[model samples]
Target chain A: MRIVLHIWRQKNGRSSGKMVRYELPDINSHMSFLEMLDVLNERLIEKGEDPVAFDHDCREGICGMCGFVINGTAHGPVRGTTVCQLHMRHFQDGEELYLEPWRAKAFPVIKDLMVDRGAFDRIIAAGGYVSVSTGSAPDGNAIPIPKDNAELSMDAAACIACGACVAACPNASAALFTAAKISHLALLPQGEPERHQRSLRMVAQANTEGFGACSNVGECEAVCPKKITLENIARMFRDYIGASWTRRPAGASRG
Target chain B: MASTFQRTLRFYEATIGKKALIAVTGAILVLYVVGHMIGNLQIYLGREALNAYAHKLHDLGPLLWLVRGFLLLAVVVHIVASIQLWLMNRAARPSRYVRQSWVKATFASRTMIVTGPILAAFIVYHVLHLTVGRFHPGFNHELDVYHNVVAGFRNVPTSVAYIVAMALLGYHVSHGAWSMFQSAGLHHPRYMPIVQKAAVALAIALFVGNISIPISILAGFIR
Candidate 1:
């Protein structure tokens, strides 16, 4: 099946970019979107052109690295599938496939389709950790976490940081990302010591990093590859307000 | 703004969806409006008092800039988010407006996103046309911003625009106030309707207060 391709091309980050058209006469219905791109790139390379650059790793959709907006919707029209997992069979023959990188001031295009997502990392670093003693891994059963809480923790722990939630969000908020991290720890035993501080710090960091504030749009979870819920955001909000009120001035820096 | 390379590699750089940005920015603007109103009440003290109060607020300088900048950022984010969501929503299921019998919802709820940025854009022009003295075809700095505002509203078309926009503003804010709480995850079933009603009342109050400036000016009451 021949499909018309409108793919973004740029020399580098500083260079002006434009959509370059390509025509593939024979496309496998069974080929994943990435695989189709691969075939195109192979053709481009053989013909002495730069291969289309995009972000992808662990093409199985578990890793959040690979995704570009397909025909406008992030990861395409099918809900909750990564670009790598999207198959050509879902599309019809000769459909004009318009592809572009995620568009946001906070997310600048790196090359053709890749975006800088370090803001997510900074948000996580601000308070996504439980300050555990760096010695040995704790035995799984040692912490007497409540069964319900333990389950909830795993649920929040499901965030893959793909920025799908951001893509899906009307605000591009990392609410789901931050919520997953905050909730993962918020539901745990070791996390209690710094739960409030974590929420306040994470929320502040999230704002400072330029992610849109969470408005509980629920689109994040709806299109989330991991299906992270907006409820985690609620939990984080509770922790933030709770932490702000309960927290006392620090006596000294961490030893 | 950082370079494109910096954005890609930085990893954390992410935008909130345009709709959510609009919602949150609208949330912040509501706050600013509330604060503005409380301060504007100093107007009843007469021009000397109001000007003095305004001068004092201006003296806050960088702090004021910081707050204003954040608010502006929120507004930008909100507008962008609204457009993105509206586009996506339109694409997901194209909606068309038609006059027909249907189950009715609040006017504010339906048009909040549509009317919101228009109001914000008007506010920008309002400030510019009156305060900055740049947007007006007839600029006279000798005519104070207050005077420009007064005369501007006296125009029939301008006054009508304010009234229509203010009605939409009321509708948007009414739904918005309740939504912010919901976004924060306040879900007690029994309290939802009550909360929504309170939001509606607050919306009405805000709309009335804001519209008063234009309406009063047109009525020859604020001269």
Candidate 2:
């Protein structure tokens, strides 16, 4: 199968990028999208040309390290599948594929199809974790969490911080990512102590990162490789609103 | 330690806070629209019944103004929050997608900005045309509400504009009615499907009900 790729290319973060075309006439249908890209890169290297740059740590898709917009979709056209797992068989012969990085103020393009998603790290740092004292790992059974809560928590925990939600969102909002983080913790007893503050701080951090507001658009859920739902976003909204009403000023009287 | 007022100010600064304001104000506006549509429906009950209903409303006097004042506040907040969030949303993506395509967003969901301003402009024209008689072709200042409505819809262009605006409102409400829940964090899996269904029904009902008047008038059924 022959595949024509119009891949965005850039020297660095500061340089302007453009779509550069690459034709691969001997492509195999069974090869993963990334594998095909590798073949193209090998050919480019043999010809002494610069290879297309992209991010990929684990081809298994669990690492959440690899992604770029494949023809406008965050993780290509296949739902719930990352670019690393997308097979060439899913596409037709001689298909033209347009690849570009996630376009968001919070996720600036680094080189070619790679973008800096450091804003997600800053959001996580704000309040994505429970403040447990450093010690041995606690027994999971001791928490006595409800079965539904545990399942919901795990569902929200599936987010990989891939920036796909922001990439796919019309407003480039990080609400889905921040919401998943907030919901993942807010559902359990271990996270109860700092739930309100967690929502407040993380949401504030996401805002500071210049992510847009969530308008109930389900584009994020549709393109998310992890299948994260909009329910997490709703949960974030619920928790944030609760925090606004109950949160107190720092050093305020406890009484 | 931040002051309580300062905390409140900070809360309003976040996108969620602004969205919550939009949701609350949107709810108020939705209620007003439903009530107004029901009131307008009285026109079909004949001139006396409709005119008497208008008289009864005006009879509230100070109480009416109070409601009006509250609705005005809702409108102001809804508009302000919408503009602020819209600007922030635009700035969030400085670079546009080269070939982006929406997957799950409905037409109504994507066109809120377009529908919203058109509705706002329609509201202004509506108020001036009927309430103050500024744009009414044959507005009666004698508190003859029935005559005013009939006269207003008598103009073919005015009736067409009214129909178009109602269609836009339908589109706006279709997304907004259910979307307000998500914004308010009131969305629950158990109730969301119901809310979405109700939103569609409400949007269609409002469009049909509101436009029925103009269409009927143009057809010489209400003259």
Candidate 3:
């Protein structure tokens, strides 16, 4: 199948980018989106032209390193699949595709389709963790968690931080990502000690990073490759509001 | 004073804080609208009941001013916070999408930015026309509340504007009420559908109740 591609190209973060057109005369329907791109790069390399630079690792789609907007939808027209796993068969022959990097203030474009998602790392580092002493692994049966709670925690934990939520959101809000992390930890007993502080710090960190506020648009949940629900955002709001009123000052009253 | 000022600044700095402010102010406005609707519905009870209700409100003297002052503050805060949030959102995405699609957003949710400012403008016109007797030539400033309402709605242009504004207000409130629950951290999966339905119901009720007044006058039913 032949496809016409309009891809955004840039030399660096400071450079202004534009959509450059390319035509692929031969594309296999079975090839993944990333594989198709790899074929394009190989042809570009043979002609002594600059190849498109996009981030990818573990093409199975678990690493969350691969993504770009394809024809306006994140991870392509297919739902609950990352770019790395998206197959070329889904698209029609002689299709014209538009490719662009995830556009957000926090995630600046590095080169071509690559973007700096270090803001996500900083947000996770803020509170997306459980504090435990260095020791042998705890016995699984010792802390008996309810079946429903365990499943709920796992559901929220499925977020891969692909930045699709931020890209798809009209406001470029990171509420879905931050809320998934907060809800995942806050749901478990092991994450109880610092749950309040976690919600408070993570949300504050997200705001500090210049992400927009969530207005319950639910676009994030729609574009998420992992199918993460918007309920996590609501949970995060519940936790943050609960913490803000009850969490004490550093040297204030104990109660 | 400086510390208090800093604390207030810090409160508005967080995105969640700004959302909470919008939700609270939205709730205040919703309550006022519902109360106003019920009071105005007394117009069905004939001229005496409706005018007597207005007279009772006016007789409260300074209390009436206090309530109006609080409502004015709520409106100002709601508008300012909403505008700041919108601007921040715009700055976050400097580059617009060549193509865009909405997954779960409704027309009401997407049009809030447009409907909000229009509603604000309508409020000014409404207050000037009915409350202050400044805009409408038929407005009675001699404490004839019933005469003022009936005469104001008797104008064709004014009635049309009122109907249109009420429709926009309904759309605004429908989205606002549903989203306010999420913003205020009251979301529950089991109850969310019910809450959304209630929001839609409230919006429709307000639209019907408010528009009915002008419609009734235009039809000679309220005379």
Candidate 4:
């Protein structure tokens, strides 16, 4: 089948991006989307043209590095699946596919379909960890986390820091991504000391990083490859609001 | 509580500013409307009960003026924010990527923006007719609250406007209420649907309750 692709092309972060069109023929319907891109790149190289650049590491969908908006939906037409896991058969033989890098103020387009998602890393750096000293590994059973609680924590911790939530959101909110970390840690004993403080800090950082506030459109959950629930967003809000209303002594703003 | 500076940025002109303004103002309006409805329920407790309650509110002296000021600010913010949002949406994406399917949706949900201002106009007329007694020629300000409301509703135009405005207001409140829960991030999987239903039910209740006042007056039950 022949497919017309309108892929986003950018020389660099400083350059303006636009959709560049290309036609690929004889594509295998069984091949994964990334594989079709591979064939396109091979053809580009043979023709002495610069191949399209896109983010992908594992192609198996666990890496969380691969994602782009296809026809305005993040990670293509499928729900709860990454672009790497998307297949060519989702398109028609002569249909045109509009592909662009995930649009968010934080996720700046680096080149082609790749974006600089380092802002997600910085938000994590702000408060997304439990304090542990360098070398000695503690036993997991030491914390005595209940089975249900541990599983719930893991479910939230499954977020791979992909900006798909922000991409899918109407406001480009990173609340889903930030909430995932805040709830995952705040639920467990390991995160006890910083639970209240963590939600406040991460939420502030998310705003500082130029992400939009949550509009509760539920688009984030709809496109999340990990299928993270919007409930975590509520928990994060509850924590943030609770911390804000704690009523510290006067002149405490300086502290 | 992000920061004074951040809040200012969220207040001034920007995408965030407009949305924040809308949410803050909308929340205030909805809360007050619900409270107003609840307070008006005192009408069923007899005339003195309702009139005394109104007196207590008016007894706030200059503080009543302050409350009115805040409500005015809310109105300005809410209207400006909505206009900005509507314009931004128009500029950002002119056409839906998916086929537009708001057909099955109710007029109330689809027409919140239009109906909201109409409701606001109705509210202003309501205040003028019953509270100040300035707009209604037959209304006697010297007569206490109950007679003014009854006399105002006797006019055909006023009665029709009351019904139309309440209907639009109901539509705005229904969508706006549930949307607030989502905006505040209270929209969980299990709780979201319940919240939506409750918002709609509350809106309908207010619609029916408020409409009954004019209808009763028109039907000659409350002269």
In TM-score terms, which candidate is top? Answer: 2
Query: Which digits, one per residue and each the tens of the lDDT, describe model 3 over residues A1-255?
Result: 988899999899999999999999899999999999999999999999999999999999898999999988888888899999999999999999999999889889999999999999999999999989999988878998888889999998988999999999888899999998998888899999999999989998888787788988788888899998878898898888777666766666654
Give chain A TM for each model in order. 0.91, 0.97, 0.98, 0.93
Q: How would you encode candidate 2's per-residue C-alpha lDDT over B61-110 as one tens digit per residue?
A: 99999999999899989998999999999999998877778889899998
Native contacts kept, each candidate = 0.06, 0.79, 0.68, 0.14
Off by over 4 Å in 1: A135-140, A252-255, B1-114, B117-177, B183-223
Enumerate the candidates' DockQ scores in order. Answer: 0.06, 0.76, 0.58, 0.21
Full ranking by TM-score: 2, 3, 4, 1
What clash pairs does model 4 have?
none
TM-score of 3: 0.95
Give TM per candidate. Answer: 0.61, 0.98, 0.95, 0.75
- Candidate 1 TM-score, true structure as reference: 0.61
Put down candidate 4 lDDT per residue, B145-170, tens digits, no spaces.
66566677888888898788878888
First chain TM-score, candidate 3: 0.98
Q: For model 3, which pairs clash?
A: none
lDDT of 2 by residue, A1-255 (tens): 999999999889899988888899999999999999999999999999998989998899898999999888899999998999999999999999999999988888889999999999999999999887998988769769999999999998989888899999999999889999999899999899899999999999998998998988789999999898888888899999888877776777582
Per-residue lDDT value at A210 in model 2: 89
DockQ of structure 3: 0.58
TM-score, chain B, predicted structure 3: 0.96
TM-score of model number 4, chain B: 0.86
Give chain B TM-scores in order. Answer: 0.77, 0.97, 0.96, 0.86
Question: What 10-residue stretch in candidate 3 chain A is worst by lDDT?
Answer: A246-255
Return the TM-score for candidate 4, rounded to 2 decimals.
0.75
